[model samples]
Target: MAINKLPIKKLVEFRRLSKGRQQTFANRLKVTKEANSGGGDYWVRSISTISNAFRVNDNALIKAKLEEVSNLYNAEQRSQTKKMYKRNIDILTKYQNFDFSEWWPSTSLNFLPKPQSILEMHGLPIQIRPQQIFSYGAENNQSVGGIWLITWLQGYKDEDLGIYSEALFRYLSSYYSEDYIINPAACMVVDISKMKVIGYDKVIDGEIPSLLDASIAKIKAHLN
Candidate 1:
C-alpha cells in the first residue's frame, strides 16, 4: 500500500512535540485520514476570495465572497463541515481589508498561474503544497513570479517561519524551471492571522535542510 503523505506543517510541528506527543500526533494523522475520505474544503472559499481579490484588484470582492460563503455554510447539513466553514469565514471577516501592499507593491497582479505539481520530498512520503502563486510588476516583466504559502496557524515563531520559507524555496527550485521566472527573493510564507509576510532572507546557513530531513525520518518511522 502507498504511504499516506504528511503535510509539511504537520511535519514541522511533529519535530517540536515531545516524544509521547509525537506518537499521539502520528496516530491522530492516521485517524484523521481514515475519518475523512477526501480532502477538506474548510479554507477553499476563503482562499478563493482572497485570491480573487488579488486577481481582479477589487478589495470589495472579499466582503462579497465571504457573504456568499457564509450563506452556504448556514445551509450546510454536516455539523463538522459547517463549523469549519464558519471558522474560516470568521477569520476572513477580521482581515477582509487585508493589505496586499505588504507583499507586493504593484497595484495589479497578473493572471493566476495553474497549480504547480505536488512536490515530493526526495523519495519521501512527505509533500509540500504552496497555497498560491502569483506574478506582478510591469506587464512584461521577466522576474515577476512569486510563491506564497499561506498558513492560518497562529503563534508561529520567527524560527518556524524561516524553516517554512527555506523548505518552500527548495521545493520551488526543484520543481520549476527558468521559464516560470520564479523570484527566489519573492518566495515567502504569508502568516494571515499575524498579518505578516516572511521570506527566507537570512539563510539559516545549511541547517534547515538537515533539520527537515531528520524530522521527516522520524515521521516516517512513526508511520511504519
Candidate 2:
C-alpha cells in the first residue's frame, strides 16, 4: 500500500505501546488503507475523538501518540512534497511550448526526418469516458487499483494523440500526489516514477489502442 500520512507513525507509536495497547493499534491499521491514508481531516479526527469515548484500554493515549506521529510526519511530507511539486510545476510550465498542443507537433528543425511528435517529460493520462476506457489487466484480470499507463494511436486524424495528456497536467503537481509525465506516444502503463514503459503487441488488423501501444513500445525502446 502507498504509505500515507499516519500509518508509519502509528505503527511506530504502536511499538512503544504495551502489548494490550498495541492490539488496539493493530486493529486500526488492519481496518482499511483509507483509515489513516485517506486525507479527509474530519474522518481522521473522528478516529481519535470517537476513540476517546471508548479508550477502554489506553486507547486515548495510544491514539493521541499516533495522531502526533501522523501530524508530524504528514507535515514533513507536505513540506518536502511541496518543494518537489513546485519544482515539477516549474519544469512542466517552462516546457509548455513543447506540449502536445497542435500548434507545433512535428520534430525539431535541428533534428532530421522532422520528428512527428514530441514526448512531454511529464506523464499524463487521457480522460476517456467510462465507456471508452479499454481495460486489460493481467492474464487473470486481477490488475486491480493503481495508476495504469496507456498508449494511443495517432495519425493524420489524431495529431496530438500522444502529446500532452490534458490541459491540467502542469498545475496538478500543486494539489495531487501524481508526478506529472509525458511520453512521446501514449503507449505505456507506468507507476509514479515515470521511468518504465510497459510493452505491447498488436492485434493484426487494426485495433487502435493495441497498435498504438505496440508502436509506442518500439519507439520508446530506441529512445532509451
Q: How many steric overlaps are in each model, in order? A: 0, 12
Candidate 1 local Cα displacement, residue 211, angstroms: 4.4
lDDT of each: 0.62, 0.27
Task: For candidate 2, write residues 81-118 as lDDT tens digits.
Answer: 54543433332232223222121112211111111121
RMSD of each: 4.4, 22.4
lDDT by residue (37-136, candidate 1, tens digit) is: 1233556676666655655556788788788878889899999888877877875786678665556635565545544434556465455555556666
The CA lDDT at 91 in model 1 is: 57
Q: Candidate 1 at 174: error in angstroms?
A: 1.6
